[model samples]
Target: MRMSLDLQHLGREEEALQVAEAALTDPWVRHGDRLALQRRVLRLGKPPRRWRRPPWAASAQAEPREVVVSATMIKGAAGFKSCFVVPPARNGSGGGGGGGGGATGVPRTACVEELALLHYGSPAGGGWRGVHSEGGVWTTLWALLCWDVLFMDVPEVFRSPFQTAPLDLDTDAFLPARREAVDARLQLIASGGAPDLIRAVWSRRVGTWCRGVNWERLTLDDLLQIAGCVGGLGLSVVCRLLCEDAGGWRGGMPDLLLWRPERGDAMVSEVKGPRDRLSDQQRAWLAALSAAGVRAEVLRVVEAPPPPPLPPPPRPCAECRPAEDGGTQQGTVTTSARSCTAGGKARRRRGAHVCGRRAMAVPIVCEGTEGVTGGCTTDGTGEGAVVAAASVAVEAHSGMEDDRVVINDDDDDGSGGGGEEDQQQLQ
Candidate 1:
C-alpha cells in the first residue's frame, strides 16, 4: 500500500493503480482495507476533474470522538443492582404501559445465546430462566430508569453499510439487511392500510410508553427518526423487543425511542433507575451488535447528582470537654443528673477575692445521659427524699450494668447553684 502511494505521488498513475490493485487480491486484507485499495484504484486509473474524498479516506482526527460511560457504576450509591431477566417481564418502571422496571437497560441488538454478563443478569440460574415472583426480593434499582428518555445516536457510518452490506448474515456486520428486515415487518403490520406502518409504530411506541400510546396519529418523520436510532439496529428488533404487547420482548429492552432534532438523528434508549442495569438479554444483544460492528454505548449524563451532598455530619456541643476540676470544662451535666462546682480548695466567696474581684466558674448546660436504662424509684417527699439513680451502662467485656448514683436529696432553699452539685463522691 505504501509503495502504491509512493507511485501515485511520483506521477506514475498507471503504476500506482497496478500496485494498489495487486494489494487488493490479498486474502488477509480486511473489508475496510479492500475499500481503501478500490478507492485508490479509482483515483490513480482515472482522476476526476474535481476529485472528492469520502469521509473514510480522510484522517480520523477530523471527527469528534464521543465518550461512553459505565451504567453499572453510575447506579444509586445507596442501592445498585444489575438487571436480570425476570419472568412475566415487561421490566420497565415508567413511560406509558409500565415498561416493566428500571431493569430495562438497552436496545434489542445482540443475540442472547452464548454468555451471561454480570450486572446484566442473575449470577446463577435465575436470569431469563425463571420468573421473579417476589418483587421485594431484589433490592437493587438502576438510577438511569429515572429519566423519561435515555437518548444517544449511532454514528452514520455504522448505521447503514460502509459499502457492501449483505442481505443474509450471522455474527457479521449486516445492519443494512437488518434495516430491510425491520421495514418488512413494519410493512406487514401496516398491510391493511394502517395509515403508513412505520410512522404509526413510532407514534404509538415512542413517547407515551409504560402508560398508553395514541394510535391515531402516525407520521413518516417518526419512522425515519427511529430507523436512524438504535445504533443502526433495525425496527423489527425494536418493535419485537421494545413495544408494549402482552407477548412482546417487553421484559428485555429499553423503554423509549428518542429523536435528537439538533443532530437530525434518532436514538434507542431505556430510561433506568427507579432507584440500575441492562438485562442479560440486553447484554447479549449488545454483544451481538459489537460483533457486527455497530457501536453500542452506555451513556451516563452525570454522576448521580453527587448523592444529595451528605447532610454535613453533626457538630459536638461546646461543653463536653474535660474541665480543670475533673468535670466538663463548661460544667455541662447529662440527664436528670445535676452539676455544680465543688472543688476542694479555698472556697471563692460569693463576691470576695484578695484583689477585691471575685472569680466565677463558667456555667455549663446539663445534658442527660441518653442510653442509660433502668427503672426509677421515687420517695413520697419531693425534697430531702431518698433518690437512688441507677443508670444503665455498657462495658467492653460485659452486659448492661446498672451503676447507682445515690443522692440524699439535700435541700437548698436559697440558691439553685447548689441544688445540682457535681458530687465527686458519687463516682
Candidate 2:
C-alpha cells in the first residue's frame, strides 16, 4: 500500500493500479490490508474484483442494542444523576432521594450506572438486583472458571514464579500455544461444570493475587447466580472470546450485571450519559454478547425537566375575630350592633383610624350605633362593643405611606380626630 501511494505521488497511475491489484490478490494479505488495497486500486482508476468481508469481520460489525431512559436532574456539586431513583445506601438509611449527601457521606449524585440500576429495580423495571463493576466482574469470572488452562505449563510462558499472568498472555501466540487446554476447559464449562470450577478456585485462592481476578467485587453467592443465569453455552462463548484476545477484548464489557435470583434470569447493561456514544470496543462486546444468547444492551440517560415550585404561604389578617353569628370578619367590623373596643374603652377615642402596621388602610370611625354605619365602635363606658348605624366610608388601600393613615374628616366640632396625638393613639 505504501509503494502504491509512492507510485501515485509520482504520477504513475498505471503502476499504482498494478501494485495495489497485486497486493489485493495475495492470499496471505490481512482482511484490513485487502480492504485498503481495494480502495487504493479504485482511487487509481481501476476496480478490483467484487469484495467480501471475512466471517469474523462480519460478526464484529453487528450493531449493538440500545436503551434510553430519562432521569430527574438534581442541582448539586457533582450534578450526578442517582443510580436508583431511591438507592439504598451502604448503610440502612433511607435518605438517598435528595440533592444533599446521603448517610454514607457521599453525595446523592450517583453515576449513570446507579441511576440505571435504580430504574430497573423500580416498579416499572421488573425489580432486579444489580452490581456495577464495569469489566472487572466478567474478567474475574473468566479467570476463575479457566484457572487451570491459564496457569498450565507451557514452554517459556511461565519462566517466573512471581508472574501473575503467563508471559504470552497478551500475545497472538497465547491462544494457539494452549489451544487444546482452552478447548477442554471450555467444554467442561459448557457441560455445566462452571459453578464447580469457580467455587473451587474461589475456595483455593480467595485472597491470592491474580492478574484478572478482583477479590473484592464478587461474592460466592453472586458468582453462582451469574453462572446459573448465563448458562453453559453462553458462558462458553464468553470465555472463548476472552481467551481469543485478552488484551484487546478485556476492557470493553458492560457496566452492570442485573439478575433475578429467583427466576435464574440476567442481563448486562452498558450505561451512557446524555452525550456519550459507544466506542468501537464497546460495540464489539455488545455484538458478541448478543450472539452468545446473553441479554446485553446500551442504556442512554437523558436528564428530565425539574418539577414546579411550591406555592407561597398564606397571608395573616390585619384584625380578625369571630362574629356573633359564628362567621369571622376583619377590621373590627361586624353586622351585629357591637361597639369597636380597642384595649377596652380607655384606649377608645372618637377618631377615624387605621388598623395594624401590615394591615390595609380601612378608615373606620366609631361615634355611636347611629354614627357608625360601616365599622365597629366602643360604647365609651367600656361595658361592650357596638356596631354603629351611621354609614362610615372605608377606603381600601394595600400598603402604608410613612406608616400614617391620612384622614379628611369633615366634622366641624374637631371630634373627627386627624391630629398627630390621635394618630399615635390609634397606632
Q: Give the poorly placed runs of model 1, Cα more than 4 Å off.
A: 1-224, 228-233, 236-248, 269-277, 288-295, 299-427
Tens digits of per-residue lDDT, candidate 1, 253-342, equal: 333333333344433233333224554444433333333333333322222223356676543333433455443433222323232222
Write the residue-wise lDDT of candidate 2 on 1-427 in tens digits. 8898899899887888778778866865632345456545555653353254333444534456777887655554565443433334422232111112224544355567767766666545666677777778788889999888888888998887888999899877899998999999999999999999998998898987789898877678888888898888888988997887787677778888777778888788898987678765676677667777888888888777667899976442444323664434434321112223432111222223233222232333444323433333443443334543444333332332322332333334434333323222222
Q: Which candidate is the best by TM-score?
A: 2
Poorest lDDT segment (10 consecutive residues) of candidate 1 = 135-144
Give TM-scores for every candidate, taking all chains together and pairing residue i with residue i. 0.23, 0.57
Q: TM-score of the candidate numbered 2?
A: 0.57
RMSD of each: 20.0, 12.5
Give me the candidate number with maximum lDDT: 2
Report how far off residue 87 is in candidate 2 (Å). 9.3
Kindly report which residue stretches of model 2 are placed more than 4 angstroms away from their true locations once superposed.
1-63, 74-107, 306-427
The 10-residue segment of model 2 with minimum total lDDT is 91-100
